[model samples]
Target chain A: MIEVKDLRFVYPNGVEALRGVSLKIEDGEFVAIMGQNGAGKTTLVKHFNGLLKPTKGDVYVDGVNTKDVSVATLARKVGYVFQNPDHQLFCESVEQEVAFALKNFGFDQETIEKRVSWALQLLGLTQYRQVSPFMLSGGERKRVALASVLAWDPKVVILDEPTIGQDYAQKEKLRQFIMQLRTQKKTVVIVTHDVEFVAECQPRIILMKNGKIVADGSAKEILTNPEVLLQASVIPPQITQTFHYLKDIGLPTNVIDVYEARETILEFLGETKK
Target chain B: MRFMVARESVEVIKTEKLTFTYAGRNEPSIRDVGLSIEKGEFVILTGPSGCGKTTLCRCFNGLIPHFYQGKLEGEVIVAGLKVNEHPTYELACHVGLVFQNPENQLFALSVEKDVAFGLENLGLPREEIRKRVDWAMKVAGVYELKDRAPYELSGGQQQRVAIASVLAMRPEVIVLDEPTSFLDPLGAKRIFEDIYKLNQKLGITVILVEHRLDLAAKYATRVIVMNDGRVLLDGDPREVLSLEKTRLLGVGIPKATRLYQLLKNDGIPLKSGKVPLTPEEAAEAIKEAFKSD
Candidate 1:
């Protein structure tokens, strides 16, 4: 659904955030971009939605060049959730916040209301429909941001650090939401350093370093590689590290998620009957 | 040579029935909360978002009433002065409040100017401001970026400059509200380490309001969990983290502790004296649980 050819981006002040980057995201593919701060992860994804046009090469969504598409036009197919919810939140009420996108898209009032309610109920914001968003907590506000984008039901869903401030339970809920998006055959792209969440989601991992795509592989391949993660300035999930550490101690282990780590260890111990 | 000893356990902040409501808001943001912290304690203030954790931190540095128009209904004492009685400028010298958004705090063209902003505002001599600014930048590991514009820097770099600006003031206590929310995991860990070092080297009381418990929990001596604008659980990290209430509140428990709980519930308890906080500790405990026959 997304294609980029030799894309390079530079800010107005002349900081080249992306350099000669090429990526192709197929339809219904879930990809996680991992990198350290200032690693060009955010700058690259902004091109997916025409937020930042390439300074050098071309980015295409469904065969249409991003340079030809306005941000508003791209918003119809690509819904981008920013890292900070405050940057996107301006509405007074939670319900209005979710409906803003639909209203702007010129949907009928009935469709707008139906989609808004579906998004709100899905994200568990139904109870706070009338409450001002400013009164909600940071996590709830983030959910509102997600709901706003999800209500539009764009073909591609891009979330920037969706799990940043979330707790385990909240992260689990988001994980389920991502899975639902996948089952619906939507392309999902997440720019985040949340190793555990990435491991849980099991997305195709695209690792970046110094404005370049250094490694792209499965979560099992990328997250389990301590060297690759270290080069990207990311720490592998503790459980991944824990199991990898035991590789020399004669336990067959390449587990990434905690559940897999637990079951693997338990099975190994059970087989030994120790 | 004469020897002097620092006062042990001196109360740096104390609150009595503190309550605040934002202007035009019917309900109080934070209600009837009472708490205290010592001069050198590292406290983690966390809870579900909008549970008034930020409001409580604002009370520590005189922002609740001074900057934010609000109804203050309780006493808040910080560094031996009543928070309500002091102006924000006066309190800024005693308490450094680092906000969540680095962009909000970093407005100076260059990083050095941003770091120097606080010291210069205190009307310190140019020489002293330069010295303090340099020292603060070094402590925050932002000295190299002194000439870089704040707008050009990355989220993590901007956050470091924000911290350096606050550190330059040499405040007795630093209150950072979700300072690393915009950063990645590695970036967040690095910032937490800097805050931890500041607490250790400078003896500055650190009140970090964060939800990344898996990263920040180990550094905090105390974790204050709030829900519904009230203090729900406050105590040692190990003790407070193990409670079911904290988990039920949707607060992310550290992965190691989650594994420990999982094993313990399955009748395969880790043989540790206390709950493991890191994966290594969890590994050791599991190793013990499955020792060779």
Candidate 2:
């Protein structure tokens, strides 16, 4: 579980990114934090892994105050995947890249290899195990970065903008990976602007603006409310917009994901949806 | 080849059998790409990452031969000037390139200084630079943040500053390569609106490279789809987006178009011949198709 109590953080340049924010996440819960640029989403999540300590208030991860733990110590409990994969990748090969963190946490050689292989296979990077990550495409690099973090199997995983530059098929695979993490009983927190992906994942939504939490609720509630999302520059997922269009046809109006939208449309056309 | 033509031409930019291979790389970034842009056209170029969209943009502003070390083949003419012959500084007067990352483009401490950097580099006088800087800042909607440092602003604000910096040059053509990659959809929509306004109000040639087809496809008069260093599809937004090959190439079809596809697959007829690119258009089309209900 993660607990943030009245968290506030001011950068050295006097930018107040987080202003008196408070939140809590139970174990194994998936939460998607949605907001516009510079809405304090990244700043708030950095507190989870001790990357940024709160200026005022406290953050407790697994009952331990983040203030008292070093970033390296918190790595065992929390894994953060930055928005840009290039920012964090440094290893020569994809295999070595995934093994770095596991080795750092003092895992034995056998365990490290097993975890690295499993992670690489899970993210479909097995074929490029010996290749340098620098030569990979943007989507492949993102998967490598994600595999590296997942290799360690940190109790809590946080991803920032996991869907940027990803194609439709790639996004579907990423959704499967997010679900896999939940099956492992790991806490998943995603910071992103891809409302469609958010609707597909269907996690708890947290919308922020100007260093404050504006709304928190189910994906159906927050995403369907297009006006609130538009205020922060987040458009609802495509299916929800389609459902809104079909409201005049007496089709289902509350659909958020593609499957429901597809079913509703098929029914409206008098064809049973597959 | 007399690419640096003396005679006036209708095409502002043109490329014939253009192919470029990056230095120390085996394969070509762009392959046999034949393209042309008229004086005032808003073209959206989209493809998966590493599809050579950025490399093609570099060719227009002379960055391909000037800054990047690469072997170029074929002809590229911008404002009737050969890209290989003219210097980048000279091409800057005709074409301006705004990169994806704002931090990579912004160097001056203050936003005002950054916006004025291009004008000053052109040897413009102080008063003229000031006038152009103020005008560009106001147009890009970053006037209030002029005094703040570039690092102090948000991603969207910094992108606005980048756009203003390029606009201060007052080039005949502006090429933005995913200028809104860092912001949310709404923020990106706002930035796209600003660029659309610039295209409408000033008649500046705009070439925007982006992946968010849902938000951007509506603003474009033309769409160019690329994959594996080749143009896979190019036409009006509706025609290109409706192709089956486009979806197979992993291009992000606009959501409204997807909804249309779903309806078509369900044996529902569309009222209009063209696929709807926007939500409102989609709604209108859907209402017409199901009028009997």
Candidate 3:
């Protein structure tokens, strides 16, 4: 579980990236933090892993105050995948990249090998295990970065913009991987602007604007309400927008999934035919 | 008499049996790909990662055979000059390629200096370079940010400055590779809008490589889908995007188009028989369907 208590952060350049924000995530929860570029989503998540100390209030990760623990101490419990894979990838080969973190956490050689192999297989990078990470494509390198983080088996995983350079197929695979993580009861948090992906995952949505949390709730509640989403500069999913436009024709405005919207429209067509 | 008023359609970029294999690579990156793009057309080139999208773009500005040290076999003509025959600097004036990352393209300290960097290399007069830089910055909507350092601006601002730098060259053709992957939805939309204005107002031939088709589909005059180093689909946006093959190739269909397909599959017909590319169009079709009933 992760919790933030009225967290306020001020950078050395006098930019108040976060302003009196408070939130909590239960164990095994899947939450998505969304907003514009300068909305402080990254700043807020960096505090969870002790990357940024709070200027005011407090951050607690697994019942330990973030201020008390070093970033290395929190890495054992929380894994952070940066927005740019190039920023985090330094190892020569993909296999070494995944094993570096496990070795750092003091895992034995056998455990490290097993964990690295499992992670490599999970991300479909096993075939390129011996290949230099720099030689892979941008999307493949992103998978390598993800494999490296997941290899550690951190209790809480924070992914910053995981869908940035990924294609449609890779995104589907990522969605399935996120579900697999949920089955294992690992807490997952993603900061992204990919509304279509978020609509499908349906994680608890947290909307931020100008360093403050504007709204927080289920995807259906937050995504369907246009006024609140507009405040955070989030565009609703296309299916949701279609329903919003069809509200005068007796369609509910809360539909976010395409399949659900299709079924509802089919049912409406059936009734209108009578 | 009819020819007097009709505008001539000139082919700006043409590739014939274009095959390129990078040095030390067993297989070719792009194989036997042939296509022709007319001047002033907006083309969206998209495919999955490692599917030869970037390799094909590199061929446009002579980067493959010259700078990349690749085995190039094919004919590529851009702006009346063969790609392999002329140097990249010569082609740079006619075809401006903006990379995915804006930081890679920007090097000067300030935005104005970055915009003027290309013109300076071309040995243009100082007065001419200054005028073009100001014009490009205003057109890219980055005029106010001319004094700010490249690292100080946000992602969207940095991307705009990058566009300005390319626009300053006054290139006849501009190719952007996934330019909005770093921006939010709104920022992406704004960037697309700015590019659209450039294509519409200035008649610059655009080859935009992107994955976010929902926002970009509405603006494309033509959509080219590539897979496994092959041109899979190319045609009008509606016709190409409506096909089942494009969807099976893992290209993201516009959401409005997906909704149209879903309704069509379920034995329901929208008022407009064509696929809607935007939410507004889909809503209009839905309203018409109910009104007729």
Candidate 4:
């Protein structure tokens, strides 16, 4: 569990990235933080992992104040996959990269090997286990970065832009992986601009703007609210946009899922039993 | 060759049997890819990851054989110059390649300096550099951020600055490798419109590598899909994007197109019998279907 109270943060250069943001993420909750660039979405998530301490408020992670605990201690629970894979990938090979975190956490040699193989296979990087991470493609490298983080089995996994540079198939794989994580009841948080992915996942949505939380609600509520989404610079999913544009034809504007939109349109066309 | 002599050719980019294998890699990244892009065409190159989209883009601007150590075979001619024969510096004037990551390309402290970097390297006059810098910045919609450092800006904003820097060179062929990956949908739409306008007004051939087909499909004159280092499909956007083979390859089909397919599957056909690539087009098609009934 993580909680923030009136969180405010200012960079050393005097740029206030977060302003009095307050939110609470319950245990095993799946959440998505979304907004335009520079809207303080990343700033807010950095607090969850104790990467950035609040300048004026407090962040509590697992019942401990972030200011009191060191970042190393927080690492055991929170695993952050950076926006750029290159920032975190430094091991010589894919296998070593995944094992690096487990070894650091002082896991047994046998456990480290098992976890590394498991992570590589889960992310479809087993074929590249012996290859250098630097030699992989951009998307492949992203998977390597994700494998390295997930190897530690952190309780809370925060993925920053996991869908960027990924293709449709890889994204589907990631979506399934996230669903599997949910079955295990891991707290998953993602900061992204991939609305289609969000529409499919339907995680609890938190919309931020200008360094403050503007809206927080279920995915349907936050995504279909045009006024709130507009303020955050987020465009609704294509199905929602299609339905919204068809509002003049008496179709409902709140449909975010494609299946729901299809049924609603069919019913409106007098082709279905309502 | 230090100087380039203009050749009157309508085909801005052409590749024949182009194959490349990175050093120390057994498998080829690109294989026997043959393509021809006319002047002023906006082409979207999309594929599954590691399918050689970026490697193919590098071949257009002389980066594949020149900068990247690779075994290259066959011919690629961009802006009438054989890429293997011309150095990157000479090709930079005609073909500007915007890298996948904006941070890799932007280096100046301020947006203005970054936009002017390419022009200054060409030994352009100060007045000309100033004029082009302002014009390109405004075109990419980054003029308001002229004094801000690139690092200080958001990912989307920095992407615009990178594009502006490339535009300042007035390259005839601009190949952008997923330039708007960090931008929001609205911002991405605006950038696509800007690139569309440049292609229309200046007749600059655009080769855009991207995966956001939901937003980008409408702007592309043609769509090319690759799989496992081979061109699986290439043609008009509507035709190419609607292929089952393309969909099976895991390319992102525009949601609008998907909706069209779903409707068709349910026995409701749009009046045009064509796939809609954007929401507005889909809405118009549905409205027309309703009116005809």
Candidate 5:
């Protein structure tokens, strides 16, 4: 669904964010870009939706060069969610916020209303339809921002730090919602440092460090590699660390999630007793 | 061993029958809260999001009434001073607060200048400002980045500089409200380590309002859980974390703890108690279990 070739981006102030970054993401593939601050994760996502024009190289979305497409048209196929909810949410009501994008995309009022309702229902925000956007909590505001994008029915959804500042319950809810997006065959790209969330989601991991891709592999492969994780300033999920310890005790390091870690340890103990 | 006096010997803050409600909001943000902190205790306040942790922090720093228009009831005393009667600036000298967003708190061009801005406002002598700036930088482990611009540094570095700026004032209490929420995992660990060092080495009273239970579980001596503008649980970290209700409350246990819980349930003959907080400790427990088995 997305392809980049030798993509390089330099801000007007001479800060190089992306340096010859090239990769391909197929349709319906959920990719997670993990990095510390200033790793150009945000800069890389902007190019996919035409919010940023590459200083050098090219970004192709569905075989069409991003430079050749308008941001408005590209937005219909690619959606970007900023880190701060306050920056993206500007509509007075939740219903209007979700409908704003559809109306801008030239959908009629009736169609816009239907799509808005669908997006609200998908995000579990239907009951908040009449509430002021500002009156909602931080997590609710994030849902509104996501609903605004999902309402347009974009094929690719790129979220930057979607779980930041969210509590455990909110994080779980958002993770479930993202999983639902996978069922719809939408390619999902999440840029985050929440290692546990990344582990639970088990998406393909692309680790970025200092404007470069350090490691790209499955969540288990990338997270279990402590040296790479430490160098990238990323912490492995807690369960991964637990399994590493269990491995030191002659146990297998095959567990990825916490629940699996528990079951694996229990089975190991049973085998030892037998 | 030259045993210094215990931190509990010196009381720094006390609250009694404290209640606050934001204007036009029916529910009180903080209700009938009574808490106290010794001179150098490190406390972690945690709960679900929107459970009034921020409001409780603001009350301690006098932002509840002085800066925010709200109904303030009861008394909050900080460093022998009542917050309800004092201006925020006056209260700021004894209580320095590092907010959630580092971008929102920083205003100076260079790191050294930002650290010195607070001391300068207090009208300290030039020599004192220089000495305190150096001390704060060294304490926060940002002395190497003093010449760099705050914007040019990474998020972790910027947050350290924020701590340095607040440290230059030499406040009796330092409250960090989710300082690592905007940082990566490594950055979050560094910030927490710095807070731990400050509390242990400098004898600074530290109040951390955070949602990262794994990190907080390992660091804080006292854990206070808040929900619905009230204190849900208050005790040592081990006591609060071992509750079955913790999981039901939507606050997760550390990954190591969950693993240990599983091992115990499987009749692994491990000690039954609060789970270990660190990976190293968990490894030690596993080794011990293998030896006994």
Candidate 6:
């Protein structure tokens, strides 16, 4: 759905964030952009929605070049959720926050209400419909932010650090929500530092370093490669590390998730007994 | 050998029947929270987000009523000084507070100027400010970045500069409220390592309000778990972490402890005594289990 060709982005101060990077993301694919701070992951993703224009190269969404489209019009095609929820949320009530983008896109009143309600239901935020956005907790505010973007019904959703500052349950909820988005065939691109979350989600992992794509493959391929993960300042998940150690000890198990690792170990023991 | 020292000094901070209610809110943020911390001890205050951990830390630095107007029912004393009675500037000298967002605390153009801002505000002599600025930067391990701008540094480096700025005052107690929340894992590790060095090497009394239990479990001498504006658990890390109740407390444990628990629950003949703090320790335990089997 998205294609980039030799993309290069430099800030006005002459700091190049994306340096001749290129990648192709298929339609309805869930891709995660992983990198450390200052690795230019955020700068690269901002170009997808036209929040940033590449200084030297081109970014195309569904064969439409971003350089020729207005940011607001592009935003309707590619929704972006920032790292801080407070940066995007300015409405008083939860319902109004979700409907803000729909109204801005000039949707009719009835269609806007329907989209807002559907978005709230999808994120499980309907119960907080009338509550003030400022009074909600951090996790709840993040859900509201997601709903705000999702209400616009964009083809692709880009989330920046969606799981930061969240507890285990909340993170799990977000994980499942992202999976659901993938199953619904809406392209999802997440820029994050949480390696464990990315591992659990098992999306197409794109390792970006110094404003360039270093590795692009399945999560198992990218996560198991210690050299790539280390260069990105990302750690392999504990389960992945365990399997790596077990494999070193002559156990041939390619387990990436915890449940699979448990089953593989149990099966290995059974085979030894046989 | 790590020796457990007997409590030698009176409580530097003691809360008696403390209750704090934010303006226009009927429910109190902190409710009858009675706790005490001895001198020269490291304590971790943690809970789910918006569970009054930040409010409790604010009370320590006289930001409760001095900087914020609120309904306070109980007294909070720091180093025998009542927080409510003193000005925030006076309390700031003795109780240095480092907030979660490093960008909010920094205002100077350069790193050195930011580190020396607090000391200069106290009207210390130029020589003393210079000495303290150098010492604090060295202690916080940001001396190399002295000429850099605060905005130019990474989140972790910026936080270290913020800590250095607070440490320049040489406060008796230093309270950091989720200082590593915004940082990446490596940056988070750097900040906590700095805190550990400060507490161990310099003997600074440290109180951290954090959510990352894996980092806090390794260094904090005491862990204070808060829920619903009250202290839920407080004691040594090993004792508090071993409780089954902690798993249900909604805060996560260290990765090592979780791995150990998973192995033990699977009928692995592992010593289920004290929880390991690092992955290296967990690996050792696994090796020991395999050897015995």
Candidate lDDT values, in order: 0.87, 0.87, 0.90, 0.88, 0.85, 0.82
Which stretches of candidate 2 lie above 4 Å from their native place?
A91-96, A109-140, A269-274, B1-9
Q: Give the winner by DockQ: 4 or 6.
A: 4
Task: Please give, for residues B170-249, the per-residue lDDT of candidate 3 as tens digits.
Answer: 99999999998877777888999999999999999999998879889999999999998989889999999989988887
Candidate 5: stretches off by over 4 Å: A117-132, A135-137, B1-8
Question: Better model by DockQ, 1 or 2?
Answer: 1
Question: Which 10 consecutive residues of model 6 chain B have the lowest summed lDDT?
Answer: B284-293
Sequence-dependent TM-score of model 3: 0.97
lDDT of 5: 0.85
Candidates' DockQ values?
0.59, 0.54, 0.68, 0.66, 0.67, 0.43
Highest lDDT model number: 3
RMSD of 1: 2.5
Model 4 CA deviation exceeding 4 Å by range: A270-274, B1-9, B288-293
Query: Once model 1 is optimally superposed onto the true structure by TM-score, how far is the C-alpha of residue B34 displaced, in angstroms?
Result: 1.9
What is the two-chain DockQ of model 6? Answer: 0.43
lDDT of 4 at B164: 87
- lDDT digits (tens) for residues A1-274 of candidate 5: 7999999999999999988888999999999999878888999999999999999999999999999989998999999998888889888889988888898889998889889988898777898898888877676788789889988889999998888777887788889988989999999999998888888999999888877788899998998888999888898887777767767667776566878876776776667767
Candidate 4 chain B superposition, TM-score: 0.92
Regarding TM-score, does 3 or 6 come out ahead?
3
Q: Candidate 4 lDDT, tens digit per residue, A77-112?
A: 999999899999998999988999888889999999
| After superposition, candidate 3 runs with Cα above 4 Å error | B1-5, B288-293
> Local error of candidate 2 at B102, Å?
1.4
Number of the top candidate by TM-score?
A: 3
lDDT per residue as tens, model 3, A1-274: 8999999999999988999999999999999999877899999999989999999999999899999999999998999999889999999899999999898889999999999999999999999999899878888999999999999999999999998778888888999999999999999999998998899899999999999999999999999988898787778898888887888888888998888888888888878877
lDDT of 2 by residue, A108-178 (tens): 99999899999999988998898889878776899899999999989999998888767666787888989
* CAPRI quality level assigned to candidate 2 from its DockQ score: medium
lDDT of candidate 4 over B1-293, digit per residue (tens) = 59787865599888999999999999999999999999888999999999999999988888889999989998999888999999987888888888767898888899999999888888999999999999999988899999999998877788889888888888998999998777776677777788888899888999999987887888899999998898988899999988877888899887777777777678865657667888777777666545533
Instruction: Specify the poorest-scoring 10-residue window by lDDT in model 3 chain B.
Output: B284-293
Per-residue C-alpha lDDT of model 5 across residues B66-128, encoded as one tens digit per residue: 887889998899999899888887888899999887888888989999999988887889999
